[model samples]
Target: MFRKNFIMSLMENILILFIIASVFYTSQSLQTQKTIYVPQGSITNIISQLHKKGYEVSPIDRYILSFLGQPQSGWVDIGAEKLNRVDFLYKLATAKAKMEEITLIPGETALLFFEDIASTLDLDASRLQHYYDQHADYPEAGIYADTYYVPFGINEEQLIAFLLKESTGQFQKISQKIYGTYDKKQWLRILTIASIIQKEAANTEEMPLVSSVIYNRIKKGMPLQMDGTLNYGKYSHIKVTPERIRNDKSRFNTYRYKGLPPSPIGAVSFDAIIAAIKPAQTDYLYFMKNRQGTHDFTKSYRTHRRNIQKAR
Candidate 1:
């Protein structure tokens, strides 16, 4: 009976010691960023990574996290600059990353878009461009012109990959839905035309008319001679000049080369894409910007010249 009582007393003392140690461990202060990226991995691997990053996590965290739940992969919100061990571990398994919205307005070039993203996300602009160059199949218009919500701490490569992957899926879905198949080569041609329309049209309503003029001009073997075609890459907002037209010998300079530009000039909207695929049934061969800040389209060069004079 004495031996049994001694054994029970020892067990009770051990339990009390364990409880005290747990309390001390959980109460320790931890410093972390407000936002952090959590890679996809096992619980132990995540704990090790956190330790490597100077976060005070350990093997104990792996056990604590097992009951809390799986750690969320991607950017996560810690929600505080300093937290107790338990709270930090709990947040690792629970909190969602804060998101910021990025809108890619139609007709904006990828160069400008990457610049905007770098500025907004506080990332390296060159790295963003590098990742884009590495992943994108096309030189431009790989991402659709639309708004996107990304996590606050997303890195350059992940952001570029996400945008490209999302755009590719949507592109395929739209193509398959409309044409019953997705042909990348033919689709790129459509995108090139759509990009031209995106740059030229004053509004969504004008897209189909502009598309018709493009087709009519091409059918008649006339040069596109569009000012918008010159507004490519670094010259997205720069005014097309008479000197520019005379000097530019690239395929993008429609006055110098026949057919569509070898690639898209800028990003395009769904409306522009739709218009390119199905243009208005008209014999329009020319368009000039009128005083109303819209185009006056005509088949006759005489009428177009008169419109240009009226605008001046």
Candidate 2:
């Protein structure tokens, strides 16, 4: 009877141990679930703040994640971010590595550009603007004026560098296929002209033709009487009056300047750049925009004058 009693006691002890183990396991799982979404922070500088907020993470780990993620991590980005969710973090990290579409619409100023980027990716606009100011020469060339996909978490400098690299590659391929030549100085001049044309041209079909008109005028030593160049000078929007056209002395004023502008008016789209390089073969020397964005092109002064009269 005593032997049987001893065996029963041992069984009861084993059951109690099992219950304790199960309870411990359950507690651990619940803790994990509760803490999984702890916000480690979107900005690297805010990690300490996150810690203060009771997020259990090491600064070293956060730094490593940001460094590894680079352009996509701990930078000014667009998108909703949740703290400490492993799955969410994984998605963010992956997304950062991949390229995302960034649209730069026409008529947007530099400030608008920053806001757009920030709104889309949660990036710090002030940081980006700082970089832009310091490295004005960096984005000086080859930033195509179209929507482009850029890798996430990349700093502004790296993004601009990538753009320049891609632009150079594209320029090389196009030059080889069309003109069989690549001259940096000549291309810069062409890009400068193309940027102006891009802002002026309303119709894509007319881009190459308009480019031809500009080239013809340049070759003939006639002043490029473009309105866009003058508009670039005034901060406030003004009606294009004759006085404004004649008086504005900004270097961008092609009507006043004998040659191309000092720099591009804005980022030149690939199509515009290509059109500038390979303008349509035409004898057109003059063109003018109507109330509608479309331009009327003419080969002779008489035809141009007649079109102007009709426009009036």
Clashes of each: 0, 15
Q: Where does the lowest 10-residue lDDT sum fall in candidate 2?
A: 29-38
lDDT of 2 by residue, 18-72 (tens): 8886455323311112122223346464455545655444465455456445224
Q: Count backbone overlaps in model 2.
A: 15
Q: Which lDDT tens digits does candidate 1 get at residues 1-312? A: 999999999999999999999999999999998888787899888999989989989898999999999988878878899999999999999988678898888999989898988999998888988998899877889899999998877799989999999888888888998999999898899899999999999999999999999999899888998989998988999999999999988889999998899999999899999999999999899899888899899989999899989999
Alpha-carbon local distance difference test for all models: 0.91, 0.63
Among all windows of 10 consecutive residues in model 1, the one with the lowest summed lDDT is 95-104
lDDT of 1 at 132: 89
Q: Which stretches of candidate 1 lie over 4 Å from their true place?
A: 1-25, 97-101, 122-135, 150-158
**Top-TM-score candidate index:** 1
> Which runs of model 2 end up more than 4 angstroms from their true locations?
1-53, 56-101, 106-141, 150-154, 179-182, 233-239
**Per-candidate alpha-carbon RMSD to the true structure:** 3.1, 6.9
lDDT of 1: 0.91
